[model samples]
Target chain A: MPVLHPEFWRLLSPEWVLVCFGTLFLLLSALPATRGAKRAIGVMALFGFAVVLVLCAQTLAALSPGMHVAALTGLDGQIGLTVDGFSQVFKFIFVLGALLTVLMSFKYLDVEKAWTGEYFTFLTFAVFGMMVMASGVDLLTLWVGLETMALSVYVLAAYMRRQEPSVEGATKYFLLGAFSSGLYLYGTSLIYGATGTVQLGAIRLALMDRLAHGGPAAVGFPLAAGLVILSVSLLFKAALVPFHWWTPDAYEGAATPITAFMSVAPKAAAFAMLLRIFVVGFLPLAPMWTGLLSLVAVLTMAWGNIAAMLQNNVKRMLAYSSIAHAGYALVGLVAAGRSQSNQGIAAVAFYLLVYAFMNLGAFGLVLYLQREGSAGDQMDDFDGLIQRSPLMAVLMIFFLLSLGGIPPMAGFLGKLMIFYSALDARLYLLVVVLAVTSVISLYYYFRVVYHMFLKEGAPNLPAPSAGRPLGWSLALCGVAVLAIGLYGQPFLHWASQAVLLGR
Target chain B: MTIGWILLSLMIALCALGVVLARSPISSAISLLIGFVGVAILYLALKAEFVAAVQILVYAGGILVLYLFGIMLTDNEALRLTRQTHLQAWPVFVLILVLFLAVGHKLYHSDYTPQQPDSLLMVTDQSQVQALQDRLAQEAAAARHATNPQRVARVLYGDYLYPFEAASVLLLVAVLGAVFLAKKEV
Candidate 1:
């Protein structure tokens, strides 16, 4: 007999909504009227996200706080899907980010002549993939979810086929991505060979049993190697250094709003997967993993910051900044591993939530500035933006300052929490690296601001026009950034509640 | 039985070498087909009849043919005229040697060769036969449960229903994306 709680269906309802709409959007895309059908599909996709957001909120409301009890009724043991608070919160973030992506893409799609139903369809599918990644209870589910997300993004990256740069970007992304997935699969197989199980919970129990019997001698060198290899793949997805060669090209080649989507939602998903695998599956082997990851974190921070400083194209610069942010998130994970409680994990979740808003806002502004045919993606494109449209120019400065982690916005709060936790864990070297890179990152983000407010706008930029949709989209991002920055305790409280699911 | 294992392993190694050394794409594909056939034989020797059949049907028959077609159609074939491909050969051989030695060392140290159930059951003692029979029955039951489609479906839908369903959405989006990018003319 099945576990027959009516609320059980609620756990699946968000996914159900995405599937139904994704298929509907797919079929609708097959119709001849591309733009008309695409417009309706975009609105429906937005509605779908709103509905999933509501469902996710309801599910979170129903969960008893601080409980280690089962979240999903039947599926936890059957295939390893967690219906826990952690998954719910990140699903909420994914849905919100998708909604914002659709919102920001309205103008971009029109400008790029890509206002087709398949665009929204791919977005919906990728969002579903991210949701699966966050909630996956087993390695198989996470791997599938990661691939599903990657494959969709590959198509989305090349959505503009006529453009040479776009295709070039997509090709590099697809090739590197395939290679990385192979590494990830190899790591998974190695772990399976060593542990005799694929479920994270089972791996934990197996590792514990070995530890109780003979410690590292039983777990051995190979299992440790497998964990490190698996981490490289996860780190690759999050666009860490050494594995991050694909980020700038992919981000540059994709349409702007899609780039926005790529930067925020997928990175959050990858970080969730990373935190889950480590905190749940490999927590006992912290001694082995902590040192390895801390070293990686330092390299990622240095490369991301140093490379970002050298870039002239705004998109490539943001790509490197995104890599730096991953380094900061890694620092949080390293902290979570050290502290017995869930505070470190909570700090990471909160950081991602804040990162999503600031990064999306910055990218949305990039989209807003884009003119037809030619991408307004260079720093000079932003020269003297304060002269044509003060509201946008000021908002751009706000996003830039926030990204610089100035105390005025959510980005600072996000960085502060992560640093505090690293401090708590006595990760002094990582904290110092985090501090130095952050200071360096400020230089690059402020360069955008300096060009916008301080420098002169290019003479040939089309007169600034703010469509109602674009205005509302920027307003939403701007408000979230400020709200999370000021009176952020409420958001922080909810994020702390999410860390309970780290178990 | 030992002789058969050694002979099959040697055949597989030789076939694999033929695949790597072949000059043209067609010859290389044919050699790969032969290598796959050898692997199927090895699988059959291990008593994995289903895997052996699938290996022959899929790798040797299906994917190898597809590769041949792709090689014939595309310019700048992935396979080259030069044997300078020996660059990859050195690292791959070294890696495989390391892997084989490590696994062989572990197997030898663990006394795995002496533990064959057939050798144990060959004893004439009645108590030993009964114990061996019970153990074999349990192993068979576990294997049967593992191979059964219905049980697999239960595991797929029961535990993995969300990802399973999500994969359908992924494929749908993929279909839509391909059609939009290729079929819809600007």
Candidate 2:
């Protein structure tokens, strides 16, 4: 019998924190005594996220440079959960995203008349799930983590059950999510049948062994099909084009706070899983998937930017822009595959970090403008915002500029890194598509800016007031976006340290 | 044995078709129950007795009862009217058929034999081959004595303990979500 070491629990302290806080919040939400303590619950949830973030940072600090700690090991010496720079960095991003979302949700939920304790509970649980996804080393563990996150988001999406659009979007999301999960399971089974094991290290060894003996022919068709199916399911989660139909509706219908959360936290976790699975288990098949993903990256960039140009709804436009951003991130992934170097992965990590701040800030501004009985999502809603509220207009411009990759903003640094990595990998065509699509993306992002600064507000429109928590959240995002842009060495170095520890 | 297998597969396929094609919700549900039973029997034939039992208990017993309760509670007229239309059925069927055929062809042609120590030895010396045979026989004997539930328990509690616990967390999230969505007020 194999005895689990005590150190295993120590390494997983961050996840343990989330699980405890999540369950505690779930119980607290059910109690009658806490019925009116909505802000208190949100504050406590934010505190929990802070604690998890610190723990993740501590874990990162504790690891010696170039170290991977296997948190759980089976009898055969298979690692089930790993604590490394990569996982810790992603966990930090997840916790930060959740922290910001909770901070912003306190006032939005009250405004929408949808204050419920379960909102905080699900947020904690969802972050916990994302943490699990960041650390999980086995295929089954990742899938369970993914489902935990997806299920909570589904419920959160439909939290406003009285509204038709919320329920409609949730239903569509659930049906499609279930179908993709089925495909994932089927692909897992096929791969298991082909490789005779599901462990990432074992799968890599099996593929390499097969290739050495039988060349490409020896790997067989089942494994190839399995890889394709798995990639498709993951791509669906990341909201890349062709699998992004649910995104705009879900983003538009979900409460603005969740729209912010969904576009950042869960998407980051999905990218983490993508990098883990592809870079670790499927590295040998890079030649095949790189080509396929490059094509996807091109389609996603062109279609996402083009589609965003046509949207009048600000929420829907951001949805398309988020899709375009995912495309840009995929360029780094393709670069990683081609170069087989740490530079591309580091670029992706940095990009997601920058994206979480700027994208969430953009959505936070939307939440800031939202009033009772008016979603404030239409492009016209931002008209003459400079005349009404100079502070908000300026903040919106900063976020939009950062999102459009303007110089002296964090988003520009992110795009520069990705472009540099892609260029280093000699993916010239992908680089050109990325650059052109970015220019195209600026058109839509600037359209919002123009509405805010250049156009005139309606005479009857009232100036929007931001709640204390929402203001703090937006301030934090704005500061992070600019600070990371101006002084990004430490953050960039941190991202570079998070290298995928392959077998 | 071959004839029994073939007949069982045909019956299962026919029942699946019935479940999809039946217009009445009640009829479709009954077809689903029969289909579940067919799957359970298939598991039994494959010697996965624990899975067979689970297939019957979970799908045929628990889920089927839940379905019946749902059908009973909802308006029959509404259920009939809301029956899903299958406008793209033919195209989807063709796509699935093509995929199935490709997988079947690949599986049939693949070299699926378990790796043997003799293959690694290359020389195939007599004593080594004999030792390999002895070890294989012992393993087979041990496998024969172990019940299906024991094998499942070993895997679930041993190699996959972390994921098994994670799955419990997933279930808890699901329950919480269902309550949050269904409750009239929080």
Count clashing pairs, candidate 2: 0
- Per-residue lDDT of model 1, residues A423-483, tens digit only: 9999999999999999999889888888987897767666666566667888888998898
User: i-RMS values of the candidates, in order?
Assistant: 12.4, 8.2
Predicted complex 1: DockQ: 0.18
Candidate 1 backbone collisions, by pair: A78-B159, A79-B159, A383-A456, A383-A457
TM-score, one value per model: 0.87, 0.91
lDDT tens digits by residue: candidate 2, A308-337: 999999999999999999999999998987
Candidate 2 Cα misplacement greater than 4 A, ranges: A1-4, A33-36, A70-79, B1-14, B84-145
Docking class of 2: acceptable
State, as a TM-score between 0 and 1, how close model 2 is to the true structure: 0.91
- Residue pairs in steric clash, candidate 2? none
The window of 10 residues in a row where model 2 chain A has the poorest summed lDDT is A70-79
